[model samples]
Target: MQRFDGRVALVTAAAQGIGAAVARRIAAEGGSVIVTDLQEDKVAELAAELGDRALAVRVDVTSRADLDAAVAAGVERFGRLDLLVNNAGACVVTAMPEDTTAEEWHRQLDLTLVSAAQSIQAALPHLLKTRGNVVTISSVNGLAAFGNLEYSAAKAGQLAMTQNFAARFGSSGVRFNVVAPGTIRTPNWDNQPDALDRLAKLYPLGRVGEPEDIAAAVAFLGSDDAAWITGHTLPVEGGVLTGPSALDLTPKGPFRKEQ
Candidate 1:
């Protein structure tokens, strides 16, 4: 449980939900975590809850300056960087794929994909120094037709990016992997309370996932236990990816109304 003792991690989007859970898990296991998010107050509250081992940084992942400052701050405080949890992505584009505009697509990619790459670049030097690893929070949507075209595409990009980074840095003792999750009961679902109830029926596990479920997988991937693993995507879905389900992803399902 204390596998991360003496290690340090930098987690993006650590203000709430899965990001917050991962930050809590890492800190609980004796890892010093740099918890960064655009929500300054939220991350600061989380850091306070996590105690002295946690540092709150308001990092706009889209900005290289913010990413660089966060990485620098973590290193300067924790003394070294051992893990980079790329958990900042989101499904910002609600429009149907065909009707989605170029600007929206760019914005989606900027938030969900490009920012991840920028964070890696900002942390690579420190990761290289510590022989550390990265655990990117992708989505099962990336592996299947879960709708949210822009989001899924961006999530899939994280997988490919991790693979390439793994292959490029494995020899240097740096690892990269992804955890693709199914629908979770995050604040994003607060308004769509019924949607999760309906979606759970489609999953073989008969329920949805929790942020802790993802944090557990992230802990494994970012820890020494998964030292031999690299360039892979681990689906932490509630067996939803096993086969077809009753979940309707068609434009007429719910997206058209939201659009």
Candidate 2:
């Protein structure tokens, strides 16, 4: 369970949702986690909850300076970096390709893709020192045709970046991989009516994912168990990507089971 006892992990957007879940999971498994998010108070609270094993930093991943400072602070606190979870991202708006404005496209690319690249660059030295790994939070949207065109494109870039890093850093003892989640139950759907229920039906498992589901996958990729695993995309989506949803494929008439 303590796969990362002496390790230090830096997770962005750690204030809530998948980010927070990843931070919590890492900390629970005996890792020192640097929880970075735009919300200073929430980050501080979460850090407090995690006790001294967690450090909070206000980092706007879009800002290179902020990311550098966060990485610096983590190294200063934990002495080295073992994992970097690029979790700060959002689907700002959902629109068809034609309806997506240039501004939105750039924003999506910068936050979801470019930020991860910058963070990796900043953490590279320390990671090299520790022979650490990077596990980025991508999405199933990137693996298949889903809504949010700009977001999907940016997320796809994360997967590509992982492969590039894995190929380039494999000899260096550093690994890179991605966790592509499908319809996770996060705060982003808070205002929607029966959102989890609606989304659950679309998954082959008959239920959507919880943030912890993705967190578990991330823990594996970041742990020593995954020492040989790199450039891989682990779909932690309750079987959404496996095939068609059972809900959508139920037999009708005589083939249908009696209720």
Candidate 3:
């Protein structure tokens, strides 16, 4: 739609998956994008593919210095920043509460929650200058208990962080929001057999999501179309949260079977 013509966006973890999709979408819409990831080669390849519309930077999102450098490089290249997509995150560990160690929990929070906050901190000055907005990649895990305790908690915290920032920065014309995705076919599930098929049963849409699904929603929120939208968590989960209940659909209808 060329909604982003002449704008510049910085997207974290842009080497692949949803992050890469976001970078492609933004660039396709005529935005100059700064794509950051720890995988230098892949990030560079993406930037190359995007041609002059993109710049690649290797960044460890947990490191404040790295984030500052990436932001500086983006501003230096683009002249100003119009959007920040905090897509760098991981579900480092997945275990039952009792099986999850304190260290693992901290690691998850550090990767998913703390790093997003830090990225916002690094980009706030530029955002304030341009009256830009932030669109963070959260998950359906955050809104409901879908297992992965640590990841869920961290994702939930991202939503809260976005809301708080939106409230505080609205006066400055800076907006913050989140896109909570359901089971998307990403590299993380490459090891699993038929994972997308199995996950699709839980969603009313009869299929799991693609990276482009989430990217489309992020594009909408990041565009001028969403100028009046902020502090909202948009669920791009293939109707997972609103799907019919299995128990209710059962022959017994939420009751025990005949003994």
Best by lDDT: 3
Q: Per-residue alpha-carbon lDDT of model 3 for 1-259, expressed as tens digits?
A: 4999999999999999999999999989989999999999999999999999899999999999999999999999889999999998888766778898888988898889999999999999999999999999999999998988889999999999999999999999999999999999989899997877777888877788999999999999999999999999999987879864363365754766687
lDDT (C-alpha, whole model) for all candidates: 0.92, 0.92, 0.93
Candidate 3: stretches off by over 4 Å: 244-259
Q: Which is better, 1 or 2, measured by TM-score? A: 2
Q: Ten consecutive residues with minimal summed lDDT in candidate 3?
A: 244-253
Each candidate: RMSD: 7.2, 2.6, 3.5
lDDT per residue for candidate 2 within 105-132, as digits (tens), equals 8989999999999999999999999999
**Residue-wise C-alpha lDDT for candidate 1, range 50-104, written one tens digit per residue:** 9999999999999999999999999999899999999998888567778899999
CA error at residue 31 for candidate 3, angstroms = 0.4
Among the numbered candidates, top TM-score falls to: 2
Of the two candidates 1 and 2, the one with more favorable lDDT, higher being better, is: 1
Q: TM-scores, in order shown?
A: 0.93, 0.95, 0.93
TM-score of decoy 2: 0.95
Residue pairs with backbone atoms closer than 3 Å in model 2 (clashes): none
